[model samples]
Target chain A: MKRRLPLIVVLVTAIVCMALKFLNLGERGTTLATDLDTIVQTSYLFAFLFGPIHLIRLHYSNVQKRRVNWAYSAFLVGVCAVCTVVFFINRIEGPVSTFIIDSITNATDSAIYAMLGFYVCSAAYRSFKLKNVEATILLIAAVILMLGQAPIGDAIIPNTSKFAQWILDVPNSAGMRGIRIGASIGAFAASIRVILGLERSWTGSGS
Target chain B: MDWKKLQWIDVRILYVIIVVCLLIPMFHPVGLPVAISDNTRLVYNTVESVPDGGVIWVSHDTGPGNAPELNPMIAALARQAFRKNCKIISTSLFNQTFGPVTTFEIIDEVAREMGKEYGVDWVHLGYRDNAWPATIRLMIENIIEGAINRDWKGEPLDQMPLMKQVKSIKDDVDLIFCTTVGSPGYADWMTYVSEPLHIPLTGGASLTMYSGVQPYIRSGQLKGFLGGLRGAAEYEQLVGVAGAGLAGMDAQSLGHMTVILFLVLGNIGYFAAKRAGKNQ
Candidate 1:
């Protein structure tokens, strides 16, 4: 029941969504799909609901067993209680809940985004060795693109800026176009598979 | 065999080189000049050509994680939209991230500075789940019945003056400009939103995601594209504007250059190691 029930629910939802997408099939399909979307959404909200329950249960059990940091349960409960009260009260659509939600949401978003800096830092460091001919080409292209993409590149080396523009406009676009074609082709194949019942990837097991 | 095996270089050196490269652009932006691509130029031109005080839909399908690229493009586009006194109907799909809200915040801020009134000029349709399928259904039926309004906080959308103009995704909007992050991202926006309806769609995306989305632009499935921060920087240049993309250009340029340097160094190290092993 743990796994199978969710699987069954998901398949029904996918089928309903697909049906409502193309076929009018009366309002029945539309209603089912909308309801399924709501249910899926509520399930996410339910996570917030169950989070405290899970934390309390595990922590209380740990306290009973006298686990380390068990005393911190009081702190945890206090914070959770405050948050819940705040969520419901401020959730009445005031700046209160909005502030809480937005700050946390924005901060989380910003933090994850900040990782790009580090990733690029690492990626560039690795790319420098020109591990092979491909690396060498990539190295050259990356430099030209980096230089051309900015105004400063022209400031330092004016012609390279123009050359970089050509690369970005023509070759980059061409390469990007090739990839886009490949992606659409892949999307088409995947869609066909789903329509034909050959692809049950979304279903996890069955549909 | 030892020659091949011995050539494997330590990974840490690469990390250091990339960091150094990344720092260069951070401190000094190269100011590379760019001739705006036709697609991006169209995005600007489209806004420019629109009737003054016209209504246009800004369909935001991205989150903050990808904001560094999309934000500047949208900012420049919004400036153009604002230039023509164009009304913006901003909506989003991936609402989990604060980017849409931030985008709306920017619009609201810009609009406020211009004495633009809310609902009079711009309306935000906050994040909705299952964006593609919901959007597809929305295109067929009216948005009043569609799932677009399920996540909003204001009084029911019917009351919003801005929403008064839009009957559905198919109506009341002049153009659909979607700045997206990655795949399973704008693919649906293109297939379901733009392709079926023939609404002109365009925007900037992250570099990693840019290569994959280019075909849509090529086929005119997408009216245009601003590929990552680079694309956004170019658009900013054309607009004769400066913003986050411009500020970060130095970082972007230096980062890319450093990668090239590392690639060369890594190859050299590999060949050297190979030759040393052969001599031994």
Candidate 2:
């Protein structure tokens, strides 16, 4: 009953959604779609609580167990708790909440992201080698792309930007479109399978 | 000195060299000229073509990781839009934590500088839940109902003068400018809103996603799109304002050059090692 009930709900929702999207029911269809959308928005908002609840539960368990890197988990739990309490007291857009987010959260997030730049530099130097024909082509493309993105690329090699744009517009766009079409078709098939109760992995009962 | 030894240099040394090269531009401005691309110019012209005081829906679907690349696009867009007396209704659906706050800060900064009053000239709808096509679909029908009738600050949208003017994206929005890093972005806007409503969608994406969006650009679903910081820099130039995009170009130029130099050296060492191995 546990699995079958959810599958039944999915089937109904999928059929209704498809009908609302494809069929020309006019004003009535529009109203039905809006009502269904409102229900989705409400469910989405409720689903928001699941993240924090799961986060706290996982980290609290880690802290209690004193597992490896438990100190980081404890710190995360502490920060999450403090932020939640503070947000409740002062509201999300309040001065104190804003300060914490702007100063601490944003700073840490940006700093961590910035570290990628250093790693990328190291990786490009180490991994970008001319071992074979494919590696040589990749290395050359990497050089051209890197130069083309920067202003100095034009100064050094004229029309590098134009060449880069061609690569992106022609070859890259073609590849991307093929992948997107294939992925979309795959996703449609997967969605149908889920709707028809063929895909049960999401229910944690395995497919 | 062995040629093969070039590839064996400690990664920490490469890091230091990169840091120095990147930092040099910060202290000493290069003022390099940025050539505008057709894609960027198309984005600028699309916004320019919006009827005076027409509403633009800005969906800043980005997080902190891509913020530096995309935030400048928003600032540049705001500058151009405000100059032409366009009203902006902004939303951030990428994240509840960073997207709303960062989008608000960037657009609000530009708004304050341009002396545009909030809730009148512009209103930030802020972060909505990731309901994708549904939330955006509802927004096309009714903005207030879609966003639960509240602004980012949890204030009632009815109180905002701009909200009163702009009710539904389908009827009111002249253009949809989305700076996106991933899904629920330009694709969602194009498929559900822009194509259905016939409103033009134009904006920027992180360079990482630039190639993926090119097909849309070719299809004219996106009028034209910006690619990463380079795109931001070009748009900033066209807008006649020097912001972070312009300021960071010198560093970006040096950084790219440094990487290319290392790539060349690494290759030299690799080939030399290969040749020596064959000879031995």
Candidate 3:
């Protein structure tokens, strides 16, 4: 009953949603679909509660076990507590939260992201070897694209930017479309499987 | 020509070289001449065509991580839209309130500089916790109560002068410029909102997300897209406001040059080593 009931609900909901898109059942159908969507959206609002709970639970367990870097767990818990109190009491734009987000969150994230430059250089130095035809082609294309993206590239080679745009507009688009199409087909098949109740992995074991 | 030794240089040395390369450009700007791309001009043209006082929805689907790349574009777009006296309705899909709200705070600075009033010239619809499709669908159907009943600060939408006529996104908005980092973003806007409602959609995406928009641009789903810092720089140049995008490009150029040099050196070392082994 547990599994079957959920499967039945999924099939009905999927059918209704799909039907709603194509069939114009006048004002009543529109209202029904909108109301159904409202319910779904409200349910999504409840999902946000899970994120903070999950974070607290994970860190709480870490602190309890005195795990490696448990001090960081304590710090996480402390920061989370302070932010929650500050937000609830004084809104997110309060001086404390703003400072934390701007200085700590934004600054740290940007720094970490900026480090990608170094990593990419190191990775390219180690990995971009020209031992084969494919490697040579890839190296050439990479160089062209890199040069083409920057203003200096156009200055150096009058039309490299145009060629780069062609590479992006033509070959890149073709490859991306091919991947998107395959993925969409796979997704459609999977959706149908789910709608038909054949995709029982979602229902966990015993189904 | 000890190619083997060159190949085995320590990674830290590469890091130091890149750091120096980036630093030199930052302290001493290159001021490279930026020529606008067709797609960037398309984005500018679309935004420029928004009639004075037309309401346009700016979907802020990015976070602090993408701010360096997307923020300049966002600021430039805001400046352009505000300059045209367009009513701005902004939304963020990131969580309860952090990403979109903070993004608005940045845009608010621009709005203030342009002497545009919040809740009058621009109104933030705030974070709608629903999936992008549902949120966008509700917005199209009954945006007033369904999606944005209150501002992010819990102020009623009815009180906001700019939102007075915005009962439905489909009826009210002139254009959508969605600056997004990843999924549940431009795709959702394209699938659920723009395509169905026939609203012209433009996008601003990180350089990494640039390629993903090509298919949409090709299919006419997106009017155009701004590709990362370069796109932002071009738009800044077009808007006649030299912002971070233009300033950062010098560093970006030097960084790319450094990477290209490394790639050439790496490949040369590999081939030379291979030839040396063959000769031996």
Candidate 4:
């Protein structure tokens, strides 16, 4: 019953969603969709607590066990606790809350993301070698794209921007659309499998 | 000099060189001209074509990681929209913590500079939970209900003059400008909202996503779109504002040049090593 019940719920919800999306139920259908959306949203709000609860549980267990890098876990739990308290006390949009988010959270996030720039430079220098025909083509395309994206590309090679735009408009876009279409069909099949209870890995019991 | 050794130069030296190349342009501006692309022009013209006072739904679906590339886009959009007396209804669906706060700050800053009242000219609905196509679909039906009657700062939507004028996206919105980084972004808006309702969808994406969105542009599903900081810079130029996008172009130009230079050096070393090996 434990496993069957959840699968039943998924099957019903999936069918209802698909029918609502594909059928022409008119005004009634619109209202039903909206209501379903609200229900989903409310459920999501309730599920929101699951993340922090799980985080606290895992980290607190780590702290209690004195596991490797438990200090970082403890620090994370501490920050989450303080941030939660601060947010509740001062509201999410409050000056202090905003400062903590903007100054601490956002700054750290941006700094870490910025490190990607350095790594990308190093990666390109080391890995973008011309070893064979495929490598040569890729290398040429990369150089063209790099030049085309920058203002100096046009300055150095006239019409380089136009060449770059063509590559993006033609081959790149064609490849992306193929991937997108393939992925969409795969997603559709996956959804059907989930609906039919063939994909039960999500139920935590594995398929 | 052993040419093959060039490929093995310490990565730290390369990093320092890139840093210097990026930083030098910041201190000494090269003022490289940015040519506008058809894609960027289409985005600008779409916003321009919206009747004065038309409401634009600016969905800033981004995060702190892509903020530098995307924030300038919101600022530029706000400047252009406000200049023509258009109203803006903003939301950020990307992240609860990152997108909402940064988006509100950028739009609010531009709004203040333009002397546009927040409630009347623009109202940020803030970050909705990640209920995506559904949340967006609800907004198309009724904005007030979709946002739960609260503005970004927890203010009542009914109290806001802009919100009062805007009831539903279907009836009120003129354009959907989304700055997207990933899923629940332009694709969701295009498929679930814009295409069904016939509202024009257009906006920018990170350069990484530029190619992926090109098919939509070709199909006219997206009126046109911007591609990362370069696109933002071009839009800034068109809007006649010198903001972050324009400011960062020189650095970007030099950085790209530096990478290209290293690629050439690395390739030369690669071929030399290959030739040496074959001869031996």
Worst 10 residues of 1 chain A by lDDT: A121-130
Task: Report the C-alpha lDDT of model 3 over B55-157, residue by residue, as the tens digit.
Answer: 8898888766777888788889899998999988888885344566666776799999999998889888777775657767877977777655787777888
C-alpha lDDT of all candidate models, in order:
0.67, 0.90, 0.84, 0.90
lDDT of 3 by residue, A60-93 (tens): 9999999999999999999899888887887677
Candidate 1 deviant stretches above 4 angstroms: A1-85, A92-105, A127-144, A152-207, B1-32, B145-152
How high a TM-score does candidate 2 get?
0.97
Ranking by TM-score: 4, 2, 3, 1
Chain B TM-score of every predicted model: 0.85, 0.98, 0.96, 0.98
C-alpha lDDT of residue A159 in model 4: 80
lDDT of 4 by residue, A1-207 (tens): 998999999999988888998899999988899999988888888889898899999999999999999999999999999999999999987999989988998889889988999998889999999888998899899889888888889999988878988898899989999999999999999988998999999998898
lDDT of candidate 1 over A96-119, digit per residue (tens): 766765776666777777766667
Q: What is the lDDT of residue B5 in candidate 2?
A: 80
Candidate 3 clashes between residue pairs 3 or more apart in a chain or in different chains: none
- Candidate 4 lDDT over residue span B1-280, tens digit each: 8999888889898889988988898889988898889888999999999999899999999989898889999999999999999999999998888998888889999999999998999999988888777787788888998888888778999988788788999999999999988987899998888998999999999998888999999989999899989899999999999899988888988999999889888888888899899999
Q: How far does residue B15 in candidate 1 sit from its true spot (Å)?
A: 7.2
- Per residue, candidate 2 scores C-alpha lDDT tens digits across B116-183 of 99999999989888888788888888899888899888889999889989999989999999987888
